[model samples]
Target: MNKQTETLPDQWDAPARFLHWVSAIWVLGLMGLGLAMVNLVKASGLKFDLYQLHKSYGFLFGLVLIVRLTWKFIFHRRKISNRGFLHQAAIINHNLMLLLLLTLIASGYVVTCFSIIPIPIHVFGWNVPSLLSPDMLMEQGAISVHHMIAFALLALVLVHIGAALFHHFILKDKTLIRMLK
Candidate 1:
């Protein structure tokens, strides 16, 4: 009988790949919509509508975050490769990204909750209650923090994409493929 050498897989498990793609798409699309809201719209009905859409998606993204976090702990621990420097950097980046996103969500919640003129989110027929009462000062502060975090997340996202490209094109590793379907 001849013994055959087992080969290592080039990609991640199905659940991890699905989460990665979904998160990437959600972040990219929401960021684009946000940019348009800030730059293109001129304080019109469209701007208001865009804001509502952004908030609704943000709420949805928050739910996805919860599920993803649960999946990370319960099912798939350690996102991708467990190699040397790449793995270390990936762990740091993943943790930081998750923190920033949580902060973004919380700050956004604050902004919405304490809006000058309340713009609450409604699902089905029930309204999403604002935990905090209206306060201009706090709302302004939260808005500033949210904006800063948004910019930081954007930068991190660029780095994430760059790292993937570096892995695929320069390093010629399986890192990028780990997330692909």
Candidate 2:
């Protein structure tokens, strides 16, 4: 069969696998940094530095996400199976993860735009000019949404990891092995 006709049991291509791992690292690292800045760090220069770093990395992650999605849909689309409910659930989970990441990135930009801080978003020395004026209300609202979505994404990631482990250990499947390969 041609590549497009292949099923889930087939291994993911090297670029797809690499992008998957990179996306995971970006999501987890950004989430951890965000949590640390909010819960552990106090209002100080260090806190500001951490927030700046978070924004920079977040900007990069957004680009990576876009490329990953484009690669998946245009270059290397996965064919979902009609075989079982488990396969369908996996597709849903994967799509939801992508949606959540997209939402987080958009909301994060809104939060930064409306932030009371008098600083512009500087991603790797590229100063991103804000289009919106500082509005405390909008900033607060977006922050709330961003925090909620972040926690939701974290939970979903845990579920994704659990499913992979279940497939590898319980089902003795190649699902996880294929990704690793």
Candidate 3:
């Protein structure tokens, strides 16, 4: 059999492993950025360009998430056994995380696009339409939903990381390590 078809004992394929860790790092960075932006927004009167920075980072994150999703779906990788409850739960949690991330990115972009600021930021050379123009009601609604989804995603991430740690240290399983290169 070819090397590509041969499964490693405890290591995920290089692409899967790389994307997993890189995406984790990206998420952590985004979490830090989100917290900082929230605090900065609350503490008004600061001349710092917090909103611009936050929007730029959000765009970058959204792009990365899209690419990661594409890579995940396009590439073939070794599938770990899911015969146990823990494995099934992990699979479910991981899938949920992917969904949450996509939702967060979409809502975040919509919120930013509706901003009153006239700064020109084009994605793929195409201008994204603002969800709000003279309609303040829609803007408010989208913002509310965006905030709610962000909080939900944050909660899910906490649970995911905690469960991984529990499996690694307490259960002494290969659940967490299997993804490691």
Candidate 4:
């Protein structure tokens, strides 16, 4: 039998699965928090509070992404079986998701650091200074980039979720199961 038809592993390693779920939950929650912060609130006090929380989680998410990427590099990850178009599509989607997420995170950092308004990021009660000089022009550009990337990231995430469900229910393949348990 060819490699494409060979038996696959029973399941993904525990840490890989853990990272998958953690990143998913973190990104989803951040999206909700982002929506609420922009739409549901208007008061300065509330906005500040929400922004603080958002910045904190963004930092946390960055750390998680770092670890996840490191784990993938250090360990053996299962390659997608070259069985058909569905498998290839899933691989492409996964790569795009990662790229979009990294772009989102970098633009987010630029937005906060180069903000026209200097807002200190409090991590565990310690203030972290903004990384870039205050420039109104740069701030506007960063804001634009951040927003555009965020919207793109959201669409990519939806595609990822839909692909998972399609594999699980329609394709009845091990694609989703490999990550689930």
Candidate 5:
């Protein structure tokens, strides 16, 4: 009997690929949730409940982003290999997107941590006490930064998606398929 030596393509390892899709999904979901939360805030009703749910999603996003980063560092897959100048620019743009995602998640959690709601939750079994009251000026500042980061993340994601589609349809390259697989 001949043994088949089937390995994942050289572009990305299994774990890295999994993280890529997982993070992408989570980021999209978070974007929707963030938009909903902002709308709820404007209505001045369900504000508390919406804020709590937003914080919960933010915490999850932070955890997933950290895991994805760790997996990337560990696996160290080959970078996307395309010859065109735009392809090279895509690589740089992708890195910036990752950085923006990380910033969004980190700043989101920090804003939640300083929130005044006093929701009791444990991070990795370590109790995180609320650092600031809801009306605190510092908490307000954190919230402002968090909203800015969220917008930046959304913009980056849009650019990333557009570039991927360009590569898929226009360039007709395997770059997108490499990650999809």
Candidate 6:
């Protein structure tokens, strides 16, 4: 087999699977919290608290993603069987997911950096200062981009889950089983 299509094993490494699950949990949690904060909360204090919590956890999530990507680079992940078009589609979907996530992180950072008000970003109690000066216009633009990316990510995640289920139930392949292991 060529390097691009070379099959390594039937299962992903434990660490990569762990990181994958972690990212899923964090992404879902943050999205729910964000929606609740915007739509449900009425008290300014409560809204502010939720925003801070969201930002802090998001900052931490970014670090987790960085570690996951680094680990991916340092290790050889098990490849899905080369099933032609389906295989290429899976690869494209996975890569696009990664790109969207990274873009989300960068846009989130930009939002905080250009906020009209100073937004303190803390990760596990350590404060992270803004990297850009306050600019309401830039902050608004970033906020819009962030929201758009979030919805796209959510849709992509659902598709990923659906594809996994389809593989497990219809294809009768080890595709889903490999990730689970």
- Top of the candidates by lDDT: 2
- Compose the digit string of candidate 4's lDDT tens values, residues 1-181: 2354546776878998999999999999988898899889999999889988988888779889989888886775555448677667767877888887887777777788887787866778877777788788887898788778778888878888898899789979887899887
Deviation of model 2 at 169, angstroms: 0.3
Clashing pairs in 1: none
Clash number for candidate 4 = 0
User: What is candidate 4's local distance difference test score?
Assistant: 0.82
lDDT of 3: 0.70
Model 6: per-residue lDDT, tens digit, 74-167? 6755544576877788788888888999999889889999988876797866778888999999899999999999999899888899999998
Task: Give the alpha carbon lDDT tens digit for every residue of 37-118 in model 5.
Answer: 7774665557666766666666777778788877776657444345577856876877888788877766666676666766
Ranking the candidates on TM-score from highest down gives 2, 6, 4, 1, 3, 5
How should the candidates be ordered by lDDT, best one leading?
2, 6, 1, 4, 5, 3
Off by over 4 Å in 1: 1-8, 78-82
For each candidate in turn, the TM-score is 0.89, 0.93, 0.77, 0.89, 0.77, 0.92
Which residue segments of model 5 deviate by more than 4 Å?
A: 1-11, 40-46, 77-84, 120-127, 130-135
Q: List candidate 3 segments past 4 Å from native.
A: 1-9, 40-48, 77-80, 120-134
Q: Which sections of candidate 2 miss by over 4 Å? A: 1-5
List, residue by residue over 1-181, the lDDT tens digit for candidate 1: 2144334467777877788789889978888998899899997999999988888888788888888888887886433334577767867888889899888878887889999797897555656789999999989999899989999999888888899999899989777777784
- How far off is residue 76 in model 5, in Å? 1.9
Model 3: lDDT of residue 134: 36
Candidates 1 and 3, the one with greater lDDT: 1
Model 6 misplacement above 4 A: 1-5, 77-81
**Per-candidate RMSD, Å:** 4.9, 2.6, 4.6, 2.3, 6.4, 1.9
